[model samples]
Target chain A: MLSLSSQFPILVAIAPLMTAPICALFRGKAAPWAITTIASAFAFYISLQLLLTVASSGPISYELGGWAPPWGIEYVVDLLSGFMLVLISGVSTGVLLFARESITKEVPTSQLGLFFAAYLLALTGMLGICITGDAFNVFVFLEIMSLSSYALIAMGERTDRRALTAAFQYLIIGTVGATFYLIGVGLIYMMTGTLNIADIAARFPEIEGTRPILAAVGFIVIGLAIKLALFPFHVWLPNGYTYAPSIITAFFAGTATKVSVYLLIRYIFTVFGVDYSFEGLELTDILLPLAVLGFLSMSAVAIYQSNLKRLLAYSSVAQIGYIILGLALANETGLTASIVHIFNHAIVKTGLFLSVGCMFFVVGSTYLKDLEGIGRRMPITTFGFVLGGLGLIGVPLTPGFISKWYLVVAALEKGSVIGYGIVALLMISSLLAVIYIWRVVEVAYFREMPEGTVKEEAPISLLVPTWLFILGSFYFGIETSFNVGIAKAAAAFLMGGA
Target chain B: MSFGFFNYWVFIILLMIGLYTVMSRSNLVKKMIGLSLFQISVFLFYISMGKVSGGTAPIVVDGPLDTAAPIYSNPLPHVLILTAIVVGIATTALGLSLVVRIRESFGTIDEEEILEMKDGA
Candidate 1:
C-alpha cells in the first residue's frame, strides 16, 4: 500500500479531477458549487501535505504504475512546485468560496453545473502541469487545461456574445503555442532519447552543443511565452479576460499564466540547465530587453483602457514581465525575486480582479465611466481595491514592494551600467503603475455620480472573500518568512545548478 | 546521412503552410482547419522520428534464447503521438463548436465582420 504521504502529489491533482464529472452531472448552482469547493479544498489540503513533506525531507518523486523513470511517467514535487501548488490550490479554494453567486448571475442556471465542472477540471490540468516530471506529460495536461478554458470562456456568451470571438481567438493562438511546444518536445526526444525530464537533463550535458537542442529551446520559449501572454504575443489576454465571466477572470488571473511562468523556470533551469540556456545561448540579452519593453509598454496600454477588466488584463502582462525579468536576471536574488513575485503577484491580482468582480456584481458594468463615484457606493470593496492597488504599486509594506526590492537589489548586485539602467527602467514602470491605479481611485472616489445613481455595498459573500485575498497579501507582506524562505531556497537550488 | 533530415524539411513546410492559413485567413472555420493542420504536422514529426532504416514492426518475432538481435522501430514516439493526435482532435472539436456559437450569436463567421461589430459595440 502507498503511504498517504507518498500519494499526496498525485492526490493533489486527482481530487479535483474525480469530482469534476460528478459536478457536471448535477443540476442548479448549490450542488455543483459544493462539489467544486469540496474538491478544491481537498486539493488544497493535499498541496499543504506536499509542502510540509518537501519542506522537511526535500523533494519527492513518484513513479506512475510502479514503473521506473526513463520509461514510465514521474511526478516530482520540490520546494518550487510545492510553493506554487499551495498558491494555486489555496487561491482557487478561496475563489470558490464566494464565486457561486457571481457565477449564477453571469451564467445561465442550467449551465452552472458545467461551468463549475470546467473550473475544477482546469484546476486539475494546472496542478498536473505543476507536478509532472516528464516533458510530454506537460503537453497533455496543457491541452486539457486549454480545452476547458476555451469552454469556460465561451460560456460567458450569456453575459456577452463577444466572448465567442475571444474564446476562438484564444483557441487558435493557444493551439499554435501547444503544438510548437510539442514539436520542441519531439526534437528533445530525438536528441536525448528519453522522455523523463531528469533523464534528459542527465543526457543533455553530453549532447549540449547542437543545432537541434538550440532550436528546441527557441521553440519552447516562444511557445510558453505565447501561452503566458507575454507582450507582443499577448493579443488574446485583454479581450479574453475582459469578456469572460468575472469569476473566471479572477481565477485565471491568479493561476494560469503563473503556471506557465513556473513551466518556463523549470524547463530553463532544470531541464536545459542554466549555463546552457543563459550563458551559452545569451538568452538573458534577448529576454531582458523584452521584459523591459513589456513592462513599460503594457502599463502604458493599461492606463488607456476604458474597461476595468481589460485594464487589469493588460497589467497582468506587465506583471508577467516582472516575473520574466527576474528569471532573465539569472542570479540567486533574481530567481528568488521571480519565485516570490509569482506568489505575491498571484494574490495581488486575484484581490484586484475579485474587487472588479464585486463591482460587476453591483454596478452591472465595469467600464470606467460607469464606475464614476463607486468608491462611495461600495466603500469596503473600494478599500480592498485600494489595498490591492497599493500592492501593485510596490508601496511600502505591501508584498509588491518586497518583490520589487529584491529585483532592484538583484540588478544593483550586478553593478554594471546595463544593470543600473534596468534599475531605472523598473522604477519608471512602478511610477507608471501609480498613474493607472490613481486614475481608478480618482474616478471612483472623487468623480461625481450621475444624477440618478444609487449607492450601496456589495454583498457580504463577495466582500468577505475579496477581503481575505487583500488581507493575505498584507499578511505575507508583513511576515516574509514563509514565502521568502522557500523562494530563497529555490533560487539557491537553481543558481547552484547553473 | 545524405537525406537523413528530409523529414524535418517536410515538417517545416507543412507547419509554415498551416501557420500562414491561420494568420492570413479571416474565416473562423478556416482558422480552425489551420490549427488542426499545424497540430497534424507535429504528429507527423513525432511519428517520423520513430522510423528505423532497416527495422520492421516493433512487435517481437518468435525468438530463441539470446540469438541474433532483431531490429525494431522505436515504439514510444508512436505512443506519444497517439495521445497528441487525440488532443488535436479535441482541440479541433472545441474550436469548431466555439465557431458554431459565434455564428449563432453574431450571424456571421467572418473574423473581420465580427471584430467590426465588436468595435462598433
Candidate 2:
C-alpha cells in the first residue's frame, strides 16, 4: 500500500482535479454536487493530516514524478503552506456544502456539472499553487485559478446579466496581472537558471542589487498586488464579487485573495529575502501609506453602497488592507498578526457572505431595501450575520479582536508616533465597519416586514455550514493556542528569512 | 545593453503595442487579440532567451557523455516556453468564448457602451 504521508502533498491537489472531470461527466442534479463534496472533503482531510505531519516532522518535501529539487519540480509543505492548504481546502468544503441550493438557483441546470467542475478546478489551482515549491509552476496554477474563476463568475448570468460584464472586466485585469507576473518570473529564471523557490532564495543574496532583480521584485509585487486587489489596483474586485453567484463570491471572498496574500508573503520572504526585497528597497515605506489609504478609503466607500454584496466586497478590500498592514511592519509580531488574520478573516468573511447568500436565496434580492425586515423571518441567519458582524467590528472574544490586538501590539512595538497613528486608524476603520454592518442590522430588525413577505429560513443544508463558520470565528476568538501556535512558528520561520 | 540585444528590443516594442491596444481598444474581441499579442511577445522573449550563438539543437547527437562538450542551446527555456504557450492558448480560447457570450447578452462588445447600459439600468 502507498503510504499516506509520502503521497499527502500531491494527493491534496490531484484528488480534487481528478474528480472534477468525473463531476463534469455526471448528468443528475445530486451526483455532481455529491462528487464535489466527497472530493473536497477528501482533500480537506488530507490537508489536515498533512498539517499534522508537518507539525510533527518539521516539513515534508516530495519530489514529483521521482525527480529531485533544483532540477525537477518539488512540492514543499512547510508550516506556512500547510496552514494555507488546510484553510483553502477547509473553506472549499464549507462553501461546497452551501453551494448546492444557491448554485441550482443561480446557474442553469444543463451547465450544473460543468459549474461544479470549474469550482473544483479553482480549488485545485489554489491548493496546487500553495503546495508547489517552483515559481513558474505557481504562474501556471495562477492562470488555471484565474481562468476557472472567470468561467464561474460568467455562469452567474441566469440570475443577473451584469455577470457577463463583470467576468469580462475581471478577465482583462486578471490577464494583465498574470502577464506581469510572467515577466517577473521570466526575469528571475533568466538571472538564476532555476525555478525552485528555495533554490532562488538561497541564491538571492549573492546578486541582491542587480537591476534585473530590482525590476523583478517591482514587477512581481505589482502583479500580485493587482491580483490581491490592493489599493488603486482593486477596480476589478467589487463588480466581480457583487455580480458573481453568491457561492462564488463567498468562496472568492474567503479564499482567493487570502491565497494571493499568502503567495505575496511567500515570494517576498522566500523567493527574495527581506534584506533584499524589504530593506534594500525600503518596501515598508511604500506599503505603509498604500495600506493605510486602502483600508480607510475603502471602508468609507463601503458605507454608502446599497447592494449588500457590493458593500461587503468593499469591506473585504479594507480588511485585506489590514492583512498588508501587518506585513508592512516587517517584524515577527506583525507577520504573526498577518498570518493569524488570514485564518480569522477567512472564517469571518466566509460566514458573512454565506449568510448574505442565504438572504439572497430567501428574498430573491440582496439589496438593502429588499432586506427591510428579514431579521424577524430568518432569525437564525440574522443572528449568524450579527455574530460575523461583531467579529468584523472586533468585539472582544471574537477572532477579529484577536487579529486587531496583535496588529496594535505590533505597532506599539515600533515605539513611534506613526505606529500610534496606525492604531488610531485601525480603530476608525472598525467604526466604519459598525456603520455599514449596523445599517443592515437596523434595516433588518427595525423596519416592518416588507408588506407581503413569507416567514421562512434558509434550508438546513445552508444554515449548517453558515453556523459552523460563524461558530468557528467565535471558537478561534475564545481559544488561541492552536491558531497562534501555528502562526507564530510560520512567522518565526519567515522572520528568520525563509 | 549591446547591439546583440536586438530581439529583446523588438520584444519590448511588441509588448508595448500589445499593452497599448489592450488599454485603448473598447471592442471585446480586439482586447482578447491584444492579450494574445502581449502573450505572444512574451513567448518570443522566452524563445530568444534560449538561444546560444553558435549552438544548433539541444539533441544529444554525439551520444550521451561524449568527450567533447557540444555547443547545444539551453533546453530548459524551451520547455518553460512550451508550457507558457499552452497557457496563453487556453487564455485566448477562454477570452474569446467569454466575448461570444458577452456579445450575446449586451448586443454589443464595446466596453463603454456596456457600462452605459449598466448605468442606465
Candidate 3:
C-alpha cells in the first residue's frame, strides 16, 4: 500500500503527458473536450491518492528509473507537495471543463486540439515541478511550463495584437528569470557538489559562511521573485493577464503563479532551511517591508483600473504580498497562514477570472463602463463575481477571511504594536478592495442599461465550474478543519521538519 | 591568483557585455545575444569550478595497466552544465521566434519603438 504512493507521482505526471499527445487525435469540439475532461479527472484522482497516502504515512520518496537519491533523480512527495498537487490538479480539472465552452468562443475551431495539448503540457509541467526533488529537474520542468504558457498566450494573437506583445514581453522576462535561476543553481552545485535538494540542505550548513552560497541564494531569490511577480518584478503580469484570451487568462491566473510560489517556498524552506533563510541574513528585514508596500500599493493601483481583467491582475499581485508577508514573519503561524492562503487564493482568483470569462461571453468587453447594468441581465455570473470579490476582501464566511484571521493572529504573536499595525494595514487594504469591487458592482447593478443591448448570462457549462470555486471559497471558509490541520503540519515542516 | 585569475577576468568581461546588451540595447536580437552570453558566463563558472589542480577527465578505464593513481576533475558540475546549456539554447530559440513574430506583427524589434507605437495606438 505504501508503494502505491510512489507510483502516484508518476501517474499524475504521465497521465497528462500521455493525454496531451492523444488529445491531438480528436478533431471535433466535443471529442477534444471529452478527452481533456477525462484526463484531468484521472490526474486529479491520482493527486487525491497521493495526498491521502502522505497524510496517513509520511513523505513519499520515489527514485525515477530505479535510481537512488543523492546519486540519481528523485521525486519527493511530502505533505506540502501533495497538498499543492491536489490544489493544482483539482482546479485544473474544473478549469478544463470551464475552458471547453469559453475557449470555443475565443479561439478558432482548428486550434482547439492544440490549445488542449498546451493545457495538458502545462499541467504536466506544474505537477512535475511540484513533485521532483532534484534541483536541476525543477529548471527542466519550469521550462516546460514556461514554453507551454508562451504558446497558450501567443495563441491569443487573433484576438488582439496586444497579446502578441504581452506574450513577447513575458517571454523576455521569463527567459531572463530562468537563466538567472540556472546560474544560481550552477553556483550552488559548484559549492555543494550535489543536485538533490535534500542533499544540498544537508551539505549547505557546513559551508554556510561561504560567499558563493550567499551569492547563490541572492541570485535564486531574485529570479524566483520575478517568476512569482513579487512587487517590483510584477511589470509583466497585468498586460499578460489582460491581453491573453479569456480562458488562458483564467487558467494561468489560477495555476501558473501559484505553482511558482510553491517552488519559492520549497527552495526557501526545504532547500535552504528556515534558520539560514530567516536568521542567517537580514532577509526578513528586507523582504517584509517590500511585501507590505506591495500589498498596499498594488491594491491601490488595482482600484483604479477600468479594465476588469487588469484590475484582477493587480489584485493578484497584492495577494502575493500577503503570502510573502506570512513568510517574512518566519514563525509557525505565519507559515500556516501562507500555505492556507495559497489554496484560498487559487479558489478565489479562479472564480473571479471565470466570471470575467462569463462577462466576455455576453458583452465582449471587460471595460467597466461597458458593463453598466450588466448584473441585472447576467445575474448568476455577476453574483458569483460578487461572492468572489467578497472573498478577495476577506469578508466573513469566505475562505480568505479564515486565512486573514490566522495571519492577524500570527502577526499579533510577534508581540509588537507594529505587528498589530500590520494587521490594521491589512484591514485597510481590504477596505480598498471593497471600494474597487463596489465600483464594478455600482456600474453593473445600479447604472442604466445601454440601449438595445440585451446580454444574457453565460451558458450552464461555464456557470457550473465558476460556481464550484465560488462555493468552494465559502465551504472552506466555514470548514476550517482540513485547511488548518494540513497548513499547521506543512508549516511545522517548513520550520525545518518537525 | 595568477594565470587562473586572468581567465576569470575574461569571463567577467564577457558577463558584463552580456548584461549590458540585455539592459542597454533595445533590439530584440541583440538582447538574445546578450542572453546567450549571460548563459555562457554561468557555463564558464561551472567549468572553472570543476577544474582540479592537476586532473584529467573523469573516465574510468579497466585493465591491469590502469595502475596509475589518476586524479580526475569533478564531472558532476560539467554534466549539469551540459543540461543547462541545452535549456539555454531552447530559450534562445523560443525567444528569437517570438521576436520574429513581434517584428512581423508590430513592425519593430526595437523595444522603445515598440512601446512608442503601442502608446500611439
TM-score for chain B considered on its own, for each of the candidates = 0.91, 0.89, 0.87
Query: B84-120 in candidate 2: lDDT tens per residue?
Result: 9998888888888888887888788888898788441
Q: What is candidate 3's lDDT per residue for A232-279, written digit by digit as tens? A: 899889988988888778878878988888988888887788888888
Q: Candidate 2: where is the Cα deviation over 4 Å?
A: B63-67, B118-121
Model 3 regions lying over 4 Å from their true place? A1-6, A496-498, B5-8, B118-121
Which sections of candidate 1 miss by over 4 Å? Answer: B118-121
Q: For each candidate, what is the lDDT?
A: 0.90, 0.90, 0.86
Candidate 1: docking tier: medium
Evaluated at residue A152, the lDDT of candidate 2 is 91
The local lDDT score (0 to 100) that residue B28 gets in candidate 3 is: 82
The complex in candidate 2 yields a DockQ of 0.61
Clashing pairs in 1: none
Candidate 2 chain A has its poorest 10 consecutive residues by lDDT at A270-279
Q: What TM-score does prediction 2 earn?
A: 0.98
lDDT score at residue A312, model 3, on the 0-100 scale: 97
